[model samples]
Target chain A: MAVYTEVTDEELSAFIAQYDLGAVLSCKGIAEGVENSNFLVVTERGPYILTLYEKRTRKEDLPFFLGLMEHLAEKGIACPLPVAGRDGVALRELSGRPAVIVTFLAGMWPRRISPQHCAQLGEALARLHLAVGDFRMERPNALALNGWKDLFAKSAERADEVAVGLRTTLADELAALEANWPADLPAGVIHADLFPDNVFFRGDSLSGLIDFYFACNDFLAYDIAICINAWCFEIDGSFNATKARLLLANYRKVRPLSRAELDALPWLCRGSAVRFLLTRLYDWLNHPPGAFVRPKDPLEYLRKLRFHQSVRGLGDYFLDDSATGEA
Target chain B: MAVYTEVTDEELSAFIAQYDLGAVLSCKGIAEGVENSNFLVVTERGPYILTLYEKRTRKEDLPFFLGLMEHLAEKGIACPLPVAGRDGVALRELSGRPAVIVTFLAGMWPRRISPQHCAQLGEALARLHLAVGDFRMERPNALALNGWKDLFAKSAERADEVAVGLRTTLADELAALEANWPADLPAGVIHADLFPDNVFFRGDSLSGLIDFYFACNDFLAYDIAICINAWCFEIDGSFNATKARLLLANYRKVRPLSRAELDALPWLCRGSAVRFLLTRLYDWLNHPPGAFVRPKDPLEYLRKLRFHQSVRGLGDYFLDDSATGEA
Candidate 1:
């Protein structure tokens, strides 16, 4: 863990002094992440996560991450609400790192996920999309359609050595996406990395969500596609059709996807694959080591890229539309 | 870039104090990597990379990563050779981070990878395996066969959400693997993350190997299986038969695999897929807010896992060996 920030018990208790919900008690470092230093704070008050900023994070961006949580919390989105300090500020300086405090979510990450959970995730994700649409702030998708090309350019000089065909494929895909990019659809800020860990739950009911770093403006349906790739799969690398259906149906219960979005799911999934593959490929080629940060496996994205290359339809990835009652 | 260590001009001059290599020159940050910070050091001595240790590394393990580079460089491998500092130590520390200086490598990562490049990589990887046989060091395969279960356990609660039959299928594989784990294969340290990014080349020849964080003890043949999954496919995810053949055949030239090893590729590939999928799943569930790190696409592993699920012969993947050539 990277200790991006340092905070003390007295300061924390003082910070949360005004919040009527919990009593202040103890605080200690939990884990250090690339973006923030996380401390587990136990208050006679309650449990909260104290985060101090790291190098990669700019203090200016804290409000977006913090305020979004507060906004979502008010909307019944089941996320942590940013608690303000004594001066009514949501952030503070600790260990020379930007710091903030938020409530800790409950629920163990599902290890042996069931297809039902996949379906539920899909539904819950749809709900998230609907709920957050009303939030006042907006952020454009930083990793939207053309992001892959920029990453490729960053590593293109050495693309040939990584593999012979990668360059040509990247070029071709860039062209294909450009030519076929979606122009109009439901738009909103999305929790782009809506995989299992970011979501917390108590039993079958969701408790909260964490990690809003990748949250940005993008297609509403694309977020669902990300969920399909993330939530509807088991640890064994197998896709569960039932769970995928459950997910889709659940989403429909909230804000139904438009036909354009529904029709675009397959292509969007491909884009999703491309997005991750490029980043993974970039990291692999660069091998930039950081403090306490581990490079993820690029092969997984490679496999996904390949699978999407051979995709026939979104139905194949999900099940038939009959999956959800909306069909 | 995190400056883990620095050899100021004065320090370099004093150290070379004795060596008379060249002029103390400019040190600049290199734009590469998601993990460690690197600098391109230009001295009358030549160009080198000054790396700062970050989070996912232990300084003590430098011997393994650095020594492997030396051993490979000594054997005509075109890789960075760890240079000793003024104190005659191969490593130095700056900014409280472990640091090392290495020669800069030149090459382009292949964009349109050809069968030839794949074949060459296969051959080169084989040579690497052979060279490491006498590594004179021992490191456990931290992510090998049985280790996948622990990763799955780390996030199995949501396993069912992935695929319908994933849980049961994994259960059966776990039992089968446990009951019939291969023990009598050629064992050695392997570059487990031998994906395209790790290998650099000028044209079709490999130039350097960077990032050895995942290298560990495991069956050498398993490494080959990993290569097939990585090198045998096109960017669009299609399996290139010729590429697969070239990779396998060239690999065999340096390290001929036994029948038992051949039979184990499917299981090994499956295990590899499982290993990556589990790690990726864990990351997906646990991303930190505002981290620059991008999560890998789990679908790729899902596809690879599916392919391995149905494997019945070497032919199924792409191995047709004859006494003379690849059958």
Candidate 2:
């Protein structure tokens, strides 16, 4: 059902056959992704994963995704490493789609993000930030501050369709966000989509990470902002102070955030939430029937944007009440 | 990508080949919409849209979506109806997706919702509920009660990850909701996802309704609850009473709400917000990356739920002295 692309098994087998994985034993499509075709492959040498590029993901960007995984894995990050062919290439075409073979990783994404899990994820993310430091690649953030305006342009015609004054409000926010976007800050490779689902764990212990499709060079603090929006809030849109604290505290353990990063968290969170909301709205209005996917309720992201909007401070939400209230 | 599955070039040629003709053309990969798959099928028959197999729409139920359009069209609804195929079937399968071909709808989803737009949507939805009464099909009101708990069960394993008392709080609310489930009230098919994207418009006039996937027999008041959540809230998750009132006032002009329905609106809104939050939460915690859809943050809904939960009295949010304070 997740077959958004036309990649077939035979095509993948032939593609990997060139990789000299020793010998291919079995290939099973692992329906673990909603955006791309993923498979578990066992070869004479070891187990690996074969990924067939799909829409949201471009085949040309396979090097960024595959290479990041390999770099992270080599640097002691627990993640899938794209295995190279005898010719030292990590990517090949299969079934009319770009494909790659990588070592398969284990551990389930935390279904329940406990305080401990929050702390663990925070630390893991920090470590990841540290680990990606040595990755030699240059990719601008795809969904960065400017991306919001681009999405808004697509949805402008229908912004009013979502709510009264949405377009005007969005326009105003765009101005405000633009006015406050952090200009000088530490930048590095970031796993932009670091939600619980993209993480792995074993018995309360962090296992590995996957999906660097949104990975990009951006403010480290911006990545933290994404996590805040992703992790601390509940579906009903209520902010849980404890969960927020756990996440921030754990992250600071390994990679302490700068004062500037701390100050930028609320704006970054707003940008992140609105970014997702705008995309959802655009898709909601523009979705094609043959869409292999369902559009999520953009209102959910709208709520998140609204929450960050009210947040003049991220202090009490995480560290101390007085300082956060002031922010 | 907007495949005209409801009516292919061949089918349209057969059906409208007899009617006033424009250039006949079709797109491929139409979305299997809940209410309709929109096809921009230009025909010498004049540009028209073709929708097929309105979903949740039984063969017998097609009359609701189809008939509603026809009825509204007669009353100047500005929407096309199910054009019969030459084979006499109004709905048919083409391009591996079900569809129907009708005149293409003009206008765009409004971007700036004013109190006016909210009021307009409110009136349009009520009018829709009233216009469809000529066709009768009985379906139960879902999201009535216990619906919240049922959803929670899907993510029950991780309830505690947020707080120690979420499970108990959710359980308590579920019990109360079940105890208070409305048994008898005005009933009809309601457009459940009436968020801005579903309503189309030109200038200030409402054009048509699309995406009836969630339409079903439900309490008219419950539909109002959905509107409250959809229209009366800002992106920051704050309640906008002025917009809510405008919506209700406009809706009442067309289909006046019963006093009982009004009494149920607050509970219904809470339930509506809760439903979205829980679904989003389920998606957030367990997204299979290949789904091509993004999972929304649950926190937004949670925030809305909190506001609803703390409504010591509903009158206060509306500036109505009679409804002020949490009930």
Candidate 3:
């Protein structure tokens, strides 16, 4: 819930004049996306999202995020298409920040994660992976293995303030993940942060995926692991294997997973859990008093990490019979 | 910038099912209106604002607020008309709070106010005063003279914390306003909070007025005082008399102001200043640590009150020659 930048009427009119979108009807600051200021801009043409990238999103990375959305949409994936100006440039400056207007997608993100939602999400996730296979842009996941260690270092001294043994637990997990991280797997562009809120749905079908700030080139199975942790968990800290089975099975129907990718699922899931835990821990310890956004509970990820640590093999995620006829 | 209530997809669908607004296509929480949870809901029929009344708005007052909007819109005023459900009821319950869908007005509030904006605002305000002359429902202003005492009582002990001698100054001002507040001077329904943000404009023309929760039965001149304090002050605490002259002159073109209302303007402006000062002081003192909405600086109103206290008559607001053409 953020609108960090305030766009004035004159500045907005001048900005919109660069585009073919008709006279501005209304532009409202929307309470979505924490990384930038977002406005639900309506014009004589229709509704579009005008985003002003803030300091959190590096200016150099705007091309990759904007280009990835364009490439994915051109490949028939359901996502917001960046609307370029009359000069054919999608990215421009507004209020001294990098800005762009993208066509608005129509759907509400599912608050209650149903098995059907997981199935739809699984298919969309696989399709996004396959769509971006040939795209030339490449951005390494900044919050990957090395980034986790850096975040832990920043929060390690005060980690125990959140939980009594959280500091030691994170140290041990970091060492274990460092030694056992997978060497090679099917790699492509992955939506590194595919939380349920980022995936919108219309009824039982997936409508679109959004917020590509964290999208990067990484192990595709790692994206699946992130989803299993995000969508397959209940409020009470229990994992629903049925949802996981549907997600994995539906994903495999579109793109088959290699044997090694299947075997590395547990480690990838654990790494995913630790990645979130470290970031949340860092935020929890550092968020200023009276901050607008309440930092999420880091212990939730700790609980998820414990579950993934206890997993014996792929069987723990779902029964072997659930994967019948799959690679 | 608030969306305090989270309406689920199922809850939203069920709520919209009560209306003729077609199947819900999208609903996004908008950062508008501090008092209620506002959503920009787009359906097959287009856009509307689905507002879930929060705790700050009393449930019992819902009928007066909703009916007033309906009444004003029917009288040809440019405002959001309340949309009734199929059952002919405009008010219903959503997320355990009284909710309603209002026709979406297409305009943006002026971020930088110009004298032309003030002129248009004055005309719209006078039209609003005339439109509500015959409305049946009545609600006394909750933040009027008596309410100011209650709010000061809550913050008197700490008023000095905001500024030296503030407590004594407030106590003396309250006594003076109690002695001088006009009686029997053009009373009717008044939009007591006509801040610039509540008025919308398209280019140079006034499009509509909104946030009617502050509407109530009060001295019509008091509404003018509120607007004077809101729209006539520059960001640097200086008053713009040219804008004030344009506002009052244009307003009189629609509905003439009585000589009594004109003479009472200075004291009414002082009272309006105290009204906001006490509420802001109370909020500043009582707000919990880490509150989401930062309490506004009470000193801003203190400066405005000081300026109004120094004014000798309407001449200080604008040249008397400016009102020569009007009553």
Superior by TM-score: candidate 1 or candidate 3:
3
Q: Count clashing residue pairs in model 1.
A: 76
CAPRI verdict on model 2?
A: incorrect
Per-residue error at B259 for model 3, in Å?
A: 1.5
> Distance (Å) between predicted and true CA of B30, model 2?
25
The alpha-carbon interface RMSD of model 2 comes to 20.6
Model 2 stretches astray by more than 4 angstroms: A6-9, A22-25, A44-46, A316-318, A321-327, B1-327
> Please, what are the lDDT tens digits per residue for candidate 3 over residues B1-327?
778888899899989999999989889888767778999998889989989999989988989999999999999998899899999999999989889999999888998999999888889989999999999999989998889998988899999999999999999999999999998799899998889889988877889999999899999879988998899999999999988888888888898887788888899999999998898898888888865666788999999999999999877776453334362
For residue A200, give model 3's deviation from the true position in Å.
Answer: 1.0
- The DockQ score of candidate 1 comes to 0.01
Q: Worst ten-residue run, lDDT, model 2 chain B? A: B26-35
Docking class of 1: incorrect
Residues forming the 10-long window of minimal summed lDDT in candidate 3 chain A: A318-327
lDDT of each: 0.68, 0.68, 0.89
DockQ for all models? 0.01, 0.03, 0.78
What order do you get sorting by DockQ, best first?
Answer: 3, 2, 1
Error of 2 at B212 (Å): 36
